[model samples]
Target chain A: MAKIELRGVVKRFGENTVCDGIDLDVSEGEMVCLIGSSGAGKSTLLRCINLLEPIEDGAIFLDGQDISVPGLDPQAVRARIGMVFQSFNLFPHKSALENALLAPRRVRGQSRADILPEVEALFARFGLADRMHNYPDQLSGGQQQRVAIVRALAMRPEVMLFDEITSALDPQLVGEVLDVLLTLKSEGITMVMATHEMGFAREAADKVCFLKDGRIIEEGPAAKLFDHPQHAETQAFLARALK
Target chain B: MPHQQTAGPTRRQIFEARQRRKSLVIASASTITVVVALIVLVPLAPGWSKVQQSFFNGAVLAKSFPKLLDAFMINVMIFAWSAPAIAVLGLLIALARDAKSPALFPLRIFGAAFTDIFRGVPVILTVYLIGFGIPGLGLPRPWNSPYIWGSLALVLTYSAYVAEIFRSGIDSVHKSQRAAALSLGLSERQVMQDVVLPQAVRNVVPAQMNMLIALQKDVSLLSFIGPVEIFRQAGVFKSLMANFTPYVGAAIIFLIVTIPATRYADYLMARQMRERS
Candidate 1:
């Protein structure tokens, strides 16, 4: 069974339909990369899977349970499907460790003492042990983004979603954040990401899905999709994206 | 070639020092001239002694100080009582105004109407309506006390303004913060209390402090409703002595209280800006 499944998912903002009847499936431990032009709804699709955007129609299934039904708790679904955004939204008032500790302490009803050991380990694992006390404003863009990822990981989510997470980093800093993703992948975490990093997607993704006008135009194994173009839209998108 | 180190100041450094000295001299000289002019002009004005006797008499000021202080304590008490109520009420109204749930549409409208009506009406009128109007209704003992009704009026008026400040502060927080918090599995209420309000409250501290200073002064308006605060005490002395020195004394007391508060607000704003930059 797929770890996460979306069948006929649709999202609209007022008169505009952003995610038009999308269907995708990610089996356990698979890294599916969504790639497209700026308005291709890749980010929207990733958000829908996390239940951040309520789908206008269709069902999202996580671990064979339908999560998109009306009145189902998005908060519960979101806890299982963690999301990291492009603009590293760490709470400025909180230090790095506090940001990482918030969800577990609140959502899981764990005391600070109970969660601290595990949170500290996650910080140490992410190379942020010394910087754990620093506030978001005190950290570098790269460090802040890494902290954001760790914050999501602290929830121990089953399926992780990344919405162009590295697009906002400096050229020199992007490598550090991507390296964190690589580490998470090695741990067998199920992941879906919308990315502009063609080179990273080609090298790191298990499956690459090309999207256009709110629909996935072509998808296959990473090497096959990146090296061999199957559709005219995919070819055009790649030509411009690679440039 | 060996670089030579000079014991004396460099030429550029000497020039900058001279520029600084010149500005200081000019500033002091101008300030002294203004002080001298005021001194010379003030006593020369017609009826200056009578004016002094009526408004600046040291003896009357001394006589009035203890009584006025006692009355001013009432104002302080009203302020101390109203501040927490205003803060909590304001934040609740602001959250209501920002609420997105369809179930809360009536509350949103109510919040909107509250801020608009209270902000539009002059505070003195609200004080009158509550302090006088409530008593005329003859509901109960506690409701009839000018202290209760007057403080209630100020709280109602100030909370509206503070709520607007809070709303703007909450709005100023980037939309991405909300998305980030919600995406972390936090319920909407948790997201607001944990993620949004902390940032919003920090952002508006300077504005909040300014409102608080305004509140300190507005508490004097309670005197009009017969609470016998600082302004009302000044009125009593003015009529009894047939002189205005007590009123001037009251004005000075208010300045003494509010000036430091204003300075503190400025300091907080400057520090917040420095931290952000």
Candidate 2:
């Protein structure tokens, strides 16, 4: 069974359908990238899978259990599927270490003493150990974005969602954040990201799905999709994107 | 030899130096003109001596100082007790006003109404109503004490204003911060307590301090309800001495207490602005 399954997921904002009848599957340990122009509902689809945006219709399944059944606790679903945003929304008041420790300590009911070693390891692994005590404002945009990713990882989520996480970063700094995703992929963590980074998606993604106007136009293995997009819309999008 | 380098002011440097010197001259000229005007106008005014004697008599000021200080202690005590109470009350009301749950609609309305009524009514009237009206009920000893009632009245009125300030601060936090917190599996209440409130409190520190300074001055209104605070004591001395010096003395004491607080608030505001930029 796929790690996550979205069947006929439809998300609407009033008259606008942001994710219309989306169907997709992310296999365990696979890295899937969603590529599309702005307002094509890439972000909304990822959010719906995490239950951050409730789908108006259809079901989302995690490891064979349907999670999109209106009454299921979204907080519980969110804990299982962590998300990092485009704008590195690190808590400005908290130090980087504290931001990483917050969810594990509070939601997981782990003591600071119990979680410290693990959190420290994450920071050290991410090359942020030296800057752990620095507040969000003290860090550069790339460093802050890395900390945000570390914060999501601290939840020990089954699947991670990245919503244009590097879009707000400077061109030079985007590499460092993309490098963290590569490291995560090597660890065999499942990831689904919405991105405008065509090169990174082509190089790193196991599969790439092209979306346009709230629908998936084409999807294939990353190499196949990037090398020869089957659909006209995907071809046009890549033409504009690669340009 | 290299081309001769003249170390004295270059042409551009000379022009800049001339501009600086001209600004200095203008500054000093303005300062001296203001001082000369004050010097020439003050002693030439009518009733100057009578005004001085009645308002600035050294002997009367000295005699009134100790008594006024003692009375001012009451104002300090009221402020000390009520400021924290007002803060807690205001925060609760602000949270209620900002609550999104359907069940909390009534509480939201109540919070809105409380702020509306208290902010619209003159604080003096609230003091009069609570301070005297509560005593008129012939309640227990604690309820009848003017200190208790006066402080209660002050807290009630000020919490309304402070709650609005807090609400604005809470609203100013970017929506993305809330999304980030919620996406981390924090419940709504935890999101507010851990994420939203801390940022809101930090954002409004200067505004809150300004309210505190205003609260410090508003304690004087308690004098109208017979609490014998600084202003009331000053009034009594004015009646007894048939001179206005006691009132002036009270004004000076207020300035002595509030000016430092005002300056500290200004400094904090400046620091906050600098940090944001």
Best model per TM-score: 2
lDDT string for model 1 (B1-277, tens) is: 8988889999899999999999999999999999999999999999999999999999999999889988888988999999999999999999999889999999999999999999999999999998999889877777689999899999999999999999999988898899998888899899889998999999999999999999999999888878889999999999999999999989889999999999999999999899779
**What is the per-residue lDDT of model 1 for residues A45-119, given as tens digits with 9 covering 90 to 100?**
888887778899989999999999988988888888889999999999999999999999888889999999999
Alpha-carbon RMSD, each predicted model? 2.7, 2.1
| Model 1 segments more than 4 A misplaced | B1-22, B101-105, B139-143
Off by over 4 Å in 2: B1-17
Note the clash tally of each candidate: 0, 0
Candidate 2 CAPRI assessment class: high
Top model by lDDT, which number? Answer: 2
Per model, kept true contacts as a fraction are 0.91, 0.77
- Over B180-276, each residue of candidate 2 has an lDDT whose tens digit, in order, gives 9988999988899889899999999999999999999999999888889999999999999988899999999999989999999999999999988
Best by DockQ: 2
